[model samples]
Target: MEPSVFTRIVRGELPAAKVYEDEHTIAFMDAGQVNPGHVIVATKRQVETVMELDDELAAAVFRTAARVARAVDRAYQPEGITLLQANKPAGWQTVPHFHIHVLPRHEDDGVTLGWPRKNPTLEELSVLARRIEVKD
Candidate 1:
């Protein structure tokens, strides 16, 4: 399969403002950032979504994300951080390859995640928790 743009960046085929890179993944600053210190962590593989990521790979990517988030926190010291990884187009995933965005958030940054809170009943929460527990 042809490598993705992110994979090319990982393989050193393309130049990036690289912050970190490893055998499995790479982290760099976003070219068109919504805020300052916006970083992207991507896998060397061309997995299109988080669901396609294997457990070990997912964990590694998240670990890289956490490290980059900590750095963003130290350098930018924004109000908070937003870790976002969209899937398909329905999930606002523009890139076909999988990647996580470590957005350094500030007050009124206009990068709303739009995750509305749902006050589920206790029974619903219990059922959902049980379902998740069953997966382990």
Candidate 2:
């Protein structure tokens, strides 16, 4: 199988402004940074999407992302932070690997996110919530 771009970076085969790395995860400055301290934290397992991630990978990746966000907060001190993870083309995922974008946000940063908020009734929400609840 052809290695994903992230896998190449993890292997030091490509260039990246790496921030932090552990056995299962890596944090690096995004090549196309949205902000001064924009970062990308990714799982080393090379999963194509979030649904492909195992529980361990999910936790590890988030843990690393949180750490990177805190470091960014300390370094950049932006007004807000955005932790974004997209899946599939329909979800705006450009890269195939599972990764999180840790973006530092400021007012008038020119960033915009819009989606039709489906306002559900209380009963509908409760039913949907119950449907997704972990029974175990």
Candidate 3:
């Protein structure tokens, strides 16, 4: 597969306004900020989706995102905050790399995070849950 935009950034081929960095992850200001303080925290490894992340890498990514979110809260003082992560295009993920979006929110930020809600029957939900259940 072709390299993702984020992969290019990680390889030092593309420039980014990076905010935070560690051995396993990097947090950078998003080029398209929904709000001024919107940022993206991405794993250093080129994991394509959340399911591909091992526990350690996943925890590292979230740890960086949490730290960045707290700092954004202090600096921007927005009314609220939003943490978004997408797995596939169907899940609203444009980039193929695994990353987390930290957005500072206000009442009229012009961002709509709504999706159609579905009401499933108990039997339906139970069946689906069992199908995806993880076992030790």
Q: Report the number of the highest-lDDT candidate.
A: 2
Q: lDDT tens string, model 3, 1-136?
A: 7888888898899999999999999999999998999999999888889999888998999999999999999999999999999988999889999999999999987888787889999999999898886743
Q: Point out where model 1 deviates above 4 Å.
A: 115-120, 124-136
Report the lDDT tens digits of candidate 2 across residue range 42-109: 98878889888878888899999999999999999999999999999999998899999999999999
lDDT of residue 99 for candidate 2: 98
lDDT of 1 at 112: 69
Backbone clashes for every candidate come to: 0, 0, 0
lDDT of each: 0.89, 0.93, 0.92
Better of 1 and 3 by lDDT: 3
Model 3 regions lying over 4 Å from their true place: none
